[model samples]
Target chain A: MNDTNSVVSIKDVKKAFGKNVVLDGINLEVSRGQVVVICGRSGSGKSTLLRCIDQLESIDSGEIRAAGHLMGFKEFNTKLVPLKDAAIAKQQRDIGMVFQNFNLFPHVSVLENIMLAPMKILKRKKSEVENEALALLERVGLPDKKNAYPRQLSGGQQQRIAIARALAMKPKLMLFDEPTSALDPEMISEVLDVMIDLSKAGMTMIVVTHEMGFARAAADRVILMHDAKIVEDAAPRDFFEKPRSEHTRLFLSKILQH
Target chain B: MSWSWPYFFDYMNNGLMLRGVWVTIWLSIISMTIGLGLGIFAALMKMYGNPAVRFISEFYIWLFRGTPILIQLVIIYTGLPQLGIRFNVIESCILGLALNEGAYLAEIIRSGIMSVDKGQEDASRAVGMNWRERMWLVILPQATRTIIPPLGNQFNGMLKTTSLCSVISMQELMRSAQMIAQIEFRVLEAYCIAALWYLLLVSIWGLIQTRIEAHYEKPFGSQEAVSNSEK
Candidate 1:
């Protein structure tokens, strides 16, 4: 399935731990340079699907291919060999993931947090990384907070810094897992605005969030997941206006109520 | 009679007592270093290692902590020789102190590492750092703030525990005083002088410890003192 058109593709992906099934026979295709937002109720395998894309969570069955690299167990002469942690990390570097909790390294300053990946993994020079980090911070409108610790920043600012930290790796695809779910209601817009800017800049992004307004306004394709499967996948206008699945419709109505 | 100032000064200047003080200082320093290194390793093993490693570390801590330090010292100094594992007086003293100190320090360090928020490790991994890098750069530095006060207390305890080495005839400060008292038949004067010397040394260490703690307390600064105005 060497389709150059799609940046990420999943075929019949299934993930389970013992008897607890998390993602069941999931199939997803993310096109190049398209912003896709995934929405689902809790335990719908939305975040799990995103994690599988980055190979943070391995799939039990099926194949995952991202940026032309095959995920899951690698085949070796009819035997399967799991990739080592370093190999998986190298693959994940191309797909930056922003966590729901704004997992900023609390010991580091905002600038160091952004510069760490490029400096350590990418092995860029300190001055070069610092300059790039400053530019990213400026773009996110937190250049003045370059030296502030994550604890010193508000939740919105921390998430924005997290976004900037991800961008420092210069990843081809960005994964955001409930990026604003932990933020205050008032502080959510600042993080959303930064993501909106990234979308406008044509960065390929897959965001798992309940922010229906963001899904409607910024997403090129909005996907609704239910029971470990993608129940509805369509353009934002169609998915929100005319959801076919009862689960999708019910989720929308509940989320869009207030 | 009240304390004699001239006699105290004369005792302080005695070569044997001065040498004993030096021995005590060096012994504490070496033992503390060994204890700290072992403590940190034990703590990490308890927290992050596999179950086998955790079990071994737990048993070590339990065995050392559950028993009395005096008994532990005796076991190291006296019992080991019975098994044909003989060490010199200083060596036995250091071994006893380090083992006992490591056990207590292990608990202190383990609690310190645990006190750090779990999010820090997750954050480090999210940034593409592997486990070793994450532990060294992120988790341990945050753990240092919590570990230091207890570590300081352990140091103080270890300093006093050096007196236990007198039983093994190590000729440390207490033993030196015993020897002098036996020769001069001045039990009160000799013991009083030894007490004053120990007090002097501990007081000096107290000052140094306060400075060390203060140094760590300052945020994002070099070791060089700028001015007293801020204080």
Candidate 2:
């Protein structure tokens, strides 16, 4: 990817917790409006990398730049000052994250859940936010369940509401951390359909998922991570067909077998 | 030897017994309010505060829980006098009752807070709520449902515990009963009156508890009943 067109840039990112090293010297770049899929076996730090981008997980060392703003490190007194929790939250509002668990507020209705961030963080007028929230809910095909609590919705519908809640913030980039991994097998396709439509709309997204079909169909580029490093990064067709790394070939072989 | 209804009214007519009931209600309300406030703070400190704060909270719980409430009352009301901290009988009784009750209330509040799902915290954080905001808006609201039943139990226990204050000449229910028995030499009548008053107060509190529990119960449905019934 050309350096100038990149919206997210990570360089030499290293993170460790006590004796366990999670991400070791990782580097990646994503251009504006591109869907990049990250796939790896469990414990390969795929989720940690996405978390680091949102500053949810602090990095031990490195730099990350998103939409021209430096993230993951705070500068103070000629040295980097660790960003406070509130400051990190302010930055995170610009990039919404969707979790595998669908993490909806159980007590609030679907409408309230979607409107909460916009009302609380953006201080948007409730009527205008409700209008926008209704539109997003309609888009997700859950207009009928607007007043229903999360427990009342199916896993597929809950995940769709989660997607709409993220979209309510109008984030420049969206991160999905195994969004479909926790769904029931039958519910997976509904969420994937929503994501496929989102990608077609040119929404910039970084997705950490094991769904090969989603990678093959929707991802503009696919990145394969192993042992805390990216072993292969290429267009989906080439990465699957002509994987240069032995690790990539083995990974593709194993995943394709299933 | 038979039950004497006229003697019960006679005991009620005694100014000392009537005053004792007033004093008993006053002590219960004040001590319970203080206990509930301290309980909430201790619970928050134990659950969400830093190591030092949590350590202090744990130490407070340990110190009070390790000792008997009667012993605590004696220490506060009697022992402190030797150190020149000469609080009046009412102040001493309320302080002793509040401090002892606060420890038990803290445990109740902490358990209530813990019962909330961790996912709720993550959901709140995902929406960019800070720790204080998350605790105040999300965790505490849900915790209220968990806390009410135990809080009702605590208030009932506090009503009984107020009897301990009579040891320090506080002239509350039991103390007034002792005075009336001494004057009229009607030991059975005065003591019976005090017992009846205690029962009546506790039963009334039980009614209020039922109402408060029901109010908080609406959002939670039967989940709380299943958990609390087991407890």
Candidate 3:
């Protein structure tokens, strides 16, 4: 899976927890500026795959490389060693992730939440991060929410702030894990609008969602996983219009019949 | 039961019981600070440290919490001399209080830390925060909300626990009351006065606890309402 152009290369990754295999022999490669949408049933390991890309969940055995560097290990003297937490933290700064729960820091104001990583981890100046955070707030269409606490905002607005928070780190790739699943039915499109906008701006993204409309409209490729394996990976049109596998066909019919 | 108002006034206005009250307050404050600090460290150790550290921390909590605070005070003050270790009374009192309180506080702190959602830490890690950074910036701040009310209750209990330190002859409020009772031979009256002081201190703490709870509650509740209406 090591290639010159691939931004993320996952080769034969396998992860399991206590005999419950979540990802079984998964292999994938994502290039820079590509938008990939992943859809699957609740237990299909789509979210785990996205989390594995960011090294949020440790892989059991196999390689997860982002930007040609191993995700959770450092090759030292020709031997791969698992990196320390602090070093992995520094390595992970290039990736941005958003969760279904919109886990914003509710204790601080939204501005502080956005500014914390840059100021603390990156050791950037306060005023500098402040200005950039304010700009990010504007970009997310939440200029006034700078002083607001996360719990004060609706789920849609909080998700936007969360996206802004991730963007503040200047990440090379974005991962969304069932981001809008917790929102109300009416609030889904607003968060999707933000993701669509992010896609249009050419941010590399791997999204795990149930939103088929988003997949059809925004995805370059749509990957469908079933029973811990990706059964279909194709262009959005082919996936929706001409899915090949029996599992993919059945899953599509069930999901799209609505 | 004859009561002397003048004698009681003398005990209060003069420095005897007043100084004792001061000693109790100072001891409780110092012990709580030390205990809370140790509790936080132990909680982190139990939650994230290597097996050796976790083992040591668990042993510390288990040893201290398993015994009575009174026995702990006695052992630290009297028993360690067999090992050629000697501590002054004040130091021994502090050690006993802090070690025992730290064990209980460690469990409280651990529970508070666990109450927060894992996604909060995941988000912190996503942004390149190390474990310490995630704790300082994300987990502890949220954990603090759930931690305070129980902490206040613990402190209130600590105030009463300090009475047990009286057996050590630490010149605290209860010790002073006992001394006065011995002198006047009016044990009931002296104890009643001690009871008043205890009631007064605990009542003050109850008020402060209410305020602290309200202080922490202020932002989260209002913020939710505001966020909802803003949408």
Return the top candidate by lDDT.
Answer: 3
Pairs clashing in candidate 3? Answer: A152-B227
State the RMSD for candidate 1. 3.8
Off by over 4 Å in 3: A1-4, B222-231
Task: Compose the digit string of candidate 1's lDDT tens values, residues A1-258.
Answer: 667878888899898878878888988888888999999989899988887887767788888887666764667998768887667667767777888898787656788889988997788999999999999999999998887767667899989999999899888889999999998899999999999999999888999998888988899999988888899999999998887889888998898787
Worst 10 residues of 3 chain B by lDDT: B222-231
Q: Which predicted model would earn the best DockQ? A: 3
**Individual DockQ of the candidates?**
0.31, 0.29, 0.62
lDDT of 3 by residue, B91-196 (tens): 9998899989999999999999999998898999999898899998889978888999899989998887888888878988899889988987877767777778
Candidate order (TM-score):
3, 1, 2
Better of 1 and 3 by DockQ: 3
For model 3, the docking class works out as medium
What would the per-residue lDDT of candidate 3 be over residues A1-258, giving only the tens digit for each residue? 545778888889999978999999999889988889998898899988988888888999888888556899988898888988888888789999999999998888899989989998889999999999999888888999787888778999999999999999999889999989999999999999999999999898999998999998899999989888989999999998888888888888898786
* Window of ten residues with lowest summed lDDT in model 1 chain B: B222-231
Prediction 1: B-chain TM-score: 0.89
Which stretches of model 2 miss by more than 4 angstroms? A1-6, A67-69, A121-125, B1-3, B9-26, B47-51, B77-90, B179-183, B207-231
